[model samples]
Target chain A: MMQKSTIRVLLAGAAIATVLAGCGARDKAPAAQPQVAPSVAHSSGNAGSSAEPQAPQSKPQAPQPKTASVHTYFGDENGTGLVVKQTTITYASDSDKYGAALKALQHPGDSKAVSLFDGFTFKSVKLESGKLYLDLKLDDQARTGSEAEELTLQALQKTLFQFPEVAEIYVTVDGAKVDSLMGHMDLPYPIKRSQ
Target chain B: MKRLWVGAGLLLGMLALPQVAMAAGGATTQLFLNGKPLAAEVPPRIISGNTLVPVRIIAENLGAKVGWDDRTKQVTVTSGATKLVLTIDKPEVAVGDKTEQLEVAPTIVEGNTMLPVRFVAEKLGLKVTWDELTRSVFLYKKSSGTAAADSGANGGTSGAGGSAAAGAGAAGSTGANAGAGTAGGTAAGGASAGVAHAAEPDPDSKPGIVQAIDFTGDRLTIKTNGVTTKPNLFHLSGPERLVLDVPYAVLDEALKAKLNGTVGEIAVQHPLAQKIRFSNYSSDPPTARIIIDLKGRAELVPVEAKQLQPGQFAYDLKLAKYLVVIDAGHGGKDSGAISVTGKMEKTFNLAMATKVSELLRKEPLIEVQMTRSDDTFVELDDRVAFANTRNADLFLSIHGNKYTASSTGTETYYYRDESLDFAKTIHKHLVPATGFADRGVRQEPFRVVKGTTMPGILVEVGYLSNKNDEKKMFDEAFQNQVAASLVAGIKDYLNIQ
Candidate 1:
């Protein structure tokens, strides 16, 4: 019985080594990051930031999830400019911080600022190779004039650019690229931090 | 057992093929007018490669009165001075005093008088388009003047210009029936020619009809069948004459014949005018020109021109002043935005605009005209067009702002460089009197401000979402103060002491 148990342990060790070897080349590339599926079940306490390497925990614990303090921009009272507000968002085990920060934008808090996402909801928030892709579901009444569109887009860009991991932002509606967000201004395919 | 079942299914499928083919061959045709589905008591259908629709349905929708004579088996359609008579089973149609041939004539089907769709629609001065893919026929009023058969098209009223052109063109062809009455009549007939010709170019748009121009005493009344836009009046020094150009309007047959002689002079003797002459000014846009030879050194006063009714406008030569158009933003189906107190923004805008208009009306030499006096929706394009066409010196669009609940301020926007001073002058008086935060005068390409030729500005009185601002904007005393300040600002800008 002892000999049979030793053979099973060896077989398990070899399977892990083979799986690690298959992604060995990709692990060394500087530009390539772990492609996290949005449906992956993450652990609490320490999933680590996207900028750092994730360490596997030997013993999992039911500890408190980490929270991040993010800076979000909202429309000013007159809706002609953007105003910044600091927000602290709590994340679940499987939730992404990028998504949590975006969700906080819908609520303007006590700042008396107008929300740009009033008639919109987030469909997906994804980060790949320092590029953040955001898909939004628009309501039928989601219409803005030219002035409102300019100020709202500025608010969104200012909010997302605060994250160090996000180098560029790409916005789509219901998973498809459209000509304009509110039929007023053209949306660049990948909105960079400069804009 | 499985093989037996498969054989039975195959036999059943073979029997259904003929029924599907028959359905495709006899497709039920649909009819649409101005992009709305028009349900007919008898659905339109294709017969002998021509589409036929109920006569009363198409005629009455085009704003024509239809009468059926059982004795003569005839259908008569009358619009304004124009009349069309169609006999049952006769391929010839009588329009006014002229006769035109049709491929298919009026016929009685199921006790309803049916006529060729395109022929009757064109005779009634409506644009007709046929779509074979959906087996639909679309008819539009000429005033809408859009090529696309969609409801989003601009809804301009069908002015008397088109029917006047049709009537005049029909009468003009009576003496010379051998030749087609210009391209207007041929274009209407050509658009009606066959089936599956959806790709054909649209017929020429008929211009607004100018029925009569009567000048008596100091009042000159221009009568049209439909609402004619404001006329453009200018004075010429060389001939010492005053020229009045009516846009999108054409002279009727009787009037055209009356002014057929050399120089087309109408004998008139009045203190304001010595002689009156009329002519068809521009054919492409169908503008009618009426020139008045002024006596002495009297200048033609560019004032007292008002739209008396839907299709009538009168000019009083005794008055001269500046016209200011006040526009209230958003109403009716479009409530604009709901306020923090659940009040509609359109209501506040109308109240403020009306107050300002009332104050401006009391001012000497300052004429006030409002885009809307009550709760009704007007298109953005139409508002701009109204100001430009009326030759107004200034245009002001009043609106209530909406943002976050904390938003409270007053701001004004101007698009053109020339309107910056107007914006600044208005805001200077508005902000101090309202006692709200002065958001400053800014530049934005709002539709009303950008499209108007005259100096125009759009002012946001206060944020409707803010509780304090909403309460103040709805107050009668506050409205009176704001209205007085606005009039003072206008007087300052126009240099009216």
Candidate 2:
């Protein structure tokens, strides 16, 4: 039994040694073959260049994340409101889903006349609790209303309640609020989101 | 025979003595010339006991000397090299450079050479003074110095000499009417001839119009016709400007008075270039009123006047309002990082930034401005300079994160004390709204944030390389929530709750 166990152990050791030798050979083969096709390609493309072999392209580097907060909307017996805290949202690229959802909510008959929300696209959207948050893309064509007072409120209200996740929406155009646009309206408060 | 000769000689001597006395009386009357009497139909000439004054005497008193030629029957007066020659019994006189043909000629009265008083006085450019009490007339030469002094004293209203010319012309014609119609016709013709000569070039005209005048301070309120229009304020080097558009109307007294005290000079013009300029004289922002006369046009288009600073060779940007600077990071050559699906981190950063700007502009409490609105490379120093030039209120930079394709989160940073506090407040709500991992607020020396005087912060929304983070970033619902949270955070920090 002891002899048989020793033979089996030796066989196992031989197999391990073979695997180790294969790894070593695999590792050294690329380094030893200096006149290979890749080397020739490199030399031809970068003649007289003293650059080292390029590193692998697929390796991921650590990200420098900013410190910011998040908030969510919730409806209760007390009232419909928001709960704010520190959080972060993951990055993504598909912006059409929220646009499509917002388009579904617009009144069909009045949609043509109600140009305030036309071409409205959000860079990103998030919902905390019941409240929806949107990062809007402002442009000259985004202006609303015929008069100062009407335009300001219409712009504010139209942009706020376009999604189900949002019960209330707060807007910041370029990160600040003006006393009036064109010195005409007194926008005293943040525009609340309501259907 | 001897007795007869003696009697005749005595009679001749008596006749010669009376003639001498009459000549003396005529000369005296002309020298002491008189003006027209009050309420008199005609301007009276110098007359003594129905004996008309001699033209030679009057002319001499008015700085003109006279002489007589017996062969030609002409009398001449010479004063200061100017000679006046008149022929007796002929309606004509030659005075220095000008010649005048009189209506009534010299007549022999009591053996005296008596002529028209008005004719010679006017010809010599003398002023005749009248005494209502004595009915006496005085002739005096007009002194330019004395006339100038009188004009200055009377505030330049000494146009009496011109009126005297009219009076003389009228009297000459009236006096000739008493004689034969021939004299009347001659006087009328002479008066018309003198008028033609007097009608020369005038020396007075109006002043030029002043286009604009500016006072110190930023409050530009113009009142005109009791209605005020929105004032368009701007700054120029020569003068600063506040332009108020109104219907064409004149400035009222009160408005003029206010401008006089507030501005160095107030100019009124037709607003040809559709602009008015104001110059700052003090450190404080100037407050001024521009009265626009709207000519009853109720609808006036409002125009914003941008202030431009003078550059070395170009127009510089003038800060019309408090500036807010926004910075979008990792632009141009720096792509930052790529997501699992190959989405660039810089693109996400720019997108969020654009959204943030849109949200900020909706608020009217402050002016929303950006350092960059398009996807272009902006130098670090240039961004800082733009904010500094405008005296910005806040500088917020937007950026996105990238990690080992596994990490996912949101974070915010600030380099200064206030900015750090602001980051904490903003991150407090931003992280959870997007449902990404919270990286916690931090302090770092960011180039754009550190260089400005205003409170500034930088935001990193999520890790672009992380699959989950990328998915959330691509979600439209997430970005809107993130934008709303950021705005709320700012409002909270600004005490706008």
Candidate 3:
């Protein structure tokens, strides 16, 4: 068990390193969102550091923590299937990272993609015993068809399930459990990872 | 003003495409008027976030006069002393001398002048309550002071005797008649249907208000007041009868009136059942009983019981033929996984599922159903529920996989233990036809496989991400070979010649 866990940790580190490298090589990102994929530039404290000196200087001379790029799912151009995109997120802790991932759902990587999460305002995100509870305030009149409602939940599920710690997810609107997102398709409370 | 004029044309376009039309309307929203399902050609639909219904149906049922003016493109509804005028594609409705703004304009769908029912019903002194669990809309007349008090008296009596009825135990029928402590609670049954339109917070009041027992096609749907309760099901062998006993429930007045005689027989037409019988069962603990008398040694198999809404439940019973649900995963807006060649996994899945469905249809003993026949976005939950509600014997979800380019093979997945054998049999015939590496039958918690109760399998024909696999997947001849192999596997699993 010890060896298996050690190997798993090594594989995870390698995966993160690969993602960090990819973030560094992606120079064709939109100019307005230049802060996108700043993992390598920020962590190494070199290369792009000359452009933004204060960013590196703000922290002590100690090795700066790297920004991690996570895979975020969003609605495609037609608002049909979910398209995976890499989003760079900075976090002070694990809980902060979970919140950032949820917040990322609201902003799609591309203009053509849609975000079903716009109607929800994230109230609180709590993780206990591998179960993640997300409390959100949903707009009273935000109703959609069956397909849209299902797709929205699927996107939310796919995005959050990427975190290894989140074994299950439960969503509450206005701090109350709702039967469905828009009176279409029943939502399983504490949606299992398998779901 | 110009955009409003396009409503008719837009509606026509939507109707032309059956899938689009289904999506535009909240698929499961049922409308009830005076305690019965409103027999409307078009179901209630949400347009621009507002629930709209045919004004004619509710108006006529409420004993109101409805008039349409062709020249002005306006509808005039006069219910008692209140008069309301609504113009086509207009956002404002004239209620008496006052004008009220509508968030969504009145649109003509299928020649029916659809209006936001809540606004129109309220204006006509009608009460509109929506049940989100069942997506049901209840339209009824407003209650008077005397009516409320009368219903309250019934509730008080029922509440008092609730404990005595509970003590009556499983054989509630015998103990209930003797303990008539409910004091002719039949009045509550008759009046409460009209009085209690929504689930009130009062615990003493009836929670399980059995709204209507609907028998349509091959299904029996029990509409309730959004209270969840499990019904005890048992079979009697003398004449082959199935009994369903629902606890903590009382039949609504409209439904109780349909009971016909002391036995509460409900006349129904079905291949399996000779007739259906219903009764209040008990008043204090509140229970309802439905008995289905089978015909000619017809085996009444309790296939599935689904909660259609929080308060609504449907039971499907099957006899003779085996039902197989063919699901084509992801369509229309949901392209699923995009292939290396830019082809969609949705198209491949639909094509494969359709081919297998056609083969299954030819079999005499096998009845085939497809979750979707064409390009349409069906929710994952909807697909599972659709199969479950129909009580299908087998479920097959077709899809193409997507991963790294190196991952190229055909694989089959099953979540439930019962489905493992089915998946293995299907994989045996399927993997060889793909002419790819055999990944073997594996256990995976895919939503489609996990959600379905029946022995179900999701077959990943080949990886869409791989260039070689993607090329082969697009080949029509290869698809035909896979489809034929799949059908053979199904026949093998079912032990059919």
Tell me the tens digit of each residue's lDDT in model 2 across B303-367. Answer: 23333211101111222333356677655644545566877656776777777778877865546
Candidate 3 per-residue lDDT over residues B239-283, each given as its tens digit: 566655565577788877875443466678887788787777644
What are the clashing pairs of model 3?
Answer: A80-B333, A80-B334, A81-B334, B226-B311
lDDT (tens digit, per residue) of candidate 1 on B1-497: 00100111111222222211222334666564543334454557688877898765655465678897765878888886779898998988899999998888788554357888888777766657666545667665543233233334323323434544544443333312211111111011111111111111122436677888888777677778773455655444444555565655778887888755413577787875787877665443345667677674343433343536567767655534678999988766446556777787778889989999999988877888998899997766567766764657899998887666777889888989999999999999999989999988988767678777778998888877789998998999999999898898899998889
Per residue, candidate 1 scores C-alpha lDDT tens digits across A46-145 of 3233223345446555444454444566777668877665554556642377787777777775445667777778889988888999998876334433
lDDT of 3 by residue, A1-195 (tens): 676565544434543454445544232122232223222112222322333344434557555334445556666554336666656555555566677777777777456556667657888998898999998876522333233455778878877887777899998877877545543345778799877
In model 1, residue pairs whose N, Cα or C atoms come closer than 3 Å (at least 3 residues apart or on different chains), thus clashing, are B160-B209, B161-B207, B161-B208, B161-B209, B162-B207
DockQ of 2: 0.01
Report how far off residue B402 is in candidate 2 (Å): 2.2
lDDT of 2 by residue, A42-137 (tens): 012111111323343464453221111111111111111111111111112223333333332221122112323333445555555754555555
User: Residue A13, candidate 2: how far off, in angstroms?
Assistant: 34
What CA RMSD would candidate 1 show? 20.4
Q: Candidate 1, which CAPRI tier?
A: incorrect
The parts of candidate 2 lying over 4 Å away from their true place are: A1-195, B1-323
Model 1 chain A worst lDDT run, 10 consecutive residues: A31-40
Which window of 10 residues has the lowest lDDT sum in candidate 2 chain B? Answer: B183-192
